[model samples]
Target: MKTDTVKQAESAQINVITEESKQVIYKSLLSALTIIAISILVNLSIRVDYVLLGSSLGETSVTETLQLIMLAVASWSFFLLSKQKPHFAHAAILISGFFAVLMIREMDYWMDMIHHGSWVFPALAVTALACAKAYQGGKGTVNEMATILQSPYMKLLIGSVILLVVFSRLYGMGSFWQHVMNEHYVRDVKNISEEGIELLCYSLIALSAVRTHRELKR
Candidate 1:
């Protein structure tokens, strides 16, 4: 009877822990979703303004939206990492979050280039990194190789190196690069491409959210 009682207590404790974890995860998920929604709305507003006014009324909207998105992704990623057992989904969220943060930080620089009509190369480079990271994370390649290659750390290093090279090349372009970098890159990219990139980023966030929701349900 005592043994049975002890087992029941242990089970109860585990249940409590499980419930606590679920609450934390759910809160994080909620936070991310809310932030992402706000960002999307902000971007949409900016695009509309650009189309109608032919002026950058909400020029800073994109930067603000990106910042919110980065925070949202980071919260979700941390929540995933705190799960019972870390999974590929967690890694995906983490990578996406980190990349988002980097992009957000460099938004000012990109905008400067856009204003000066020289933001193409850096913008393309950012797009490339986002696509590559999302693909790798979604496919589980990063998770699988993490054990052998030390995974996330290695991947981060590689990404940083790639960005360095790309940026260096852009800088080496001399006067043109200087002109582009000094101008606001955000205002320079065609409205269509700006909208497209925003959409793509949102899609990636949604994908991550879906995966996390599915995992939690299971």
Candidate 2:
């Protein structure tokens, strides 16, 4: 009887380990597929920008449209996170508001028609309201935000942000383009390169938002 019990326990533990290893492999495969799909979409958008959009990588291009869509998805995901996780509501609200501001900034050309640099007004309003809400949450707000910032999703988000705000801008510098292209320098080519990178950054932000939301659910 004692020998039977020992064998049963060992078999159960091995089964458990096998199940866990399967799950890890499944998740890894899924992530790999997701990355490949995103890369394909990014490449297709370039063709859409050039062929269908008259080679104009301007505000009206497919790339910019995709950027808006990705940001909107990210903002809505964070907003849902706020609703689902009440303890992290304030932090989520602040993050969603930040994405909202980015969306607004992307529409600055249309906003400019209203008034020069009119996008700043709404962006400032969102920032102030989000800050106030987070402040109202007090110390808990800081703790929640810190918890979020420590996650792998946050690392992805931060990396995407750096790509969008720092690396993309520097890489897209007109001076750099002029030096590289010399006599062949074309504004449309530069715009396409910069906008494509921005699209990828926004896509990553959307992916992180989705992953974070799913993680919280689990």
For every model shown, what is its TM-score relative to the native structure? 0.34, 0.90
The window of 10 residues in a row where model 2 has the poorest summed lDDT is: 52-61
Off by over 4 Å in 2: 1-17
Q: How many backbone clashes does candidate 1 have?
A: 15
* Per-residue C-alpha lDDT of model 2 across residues 182-203, encoded as one tens digit per residue: 9999988888788889888999
Predicted structure 1: lDDT: 0.50
Which candidate gets the maximum lDDT versus the true structure? 2
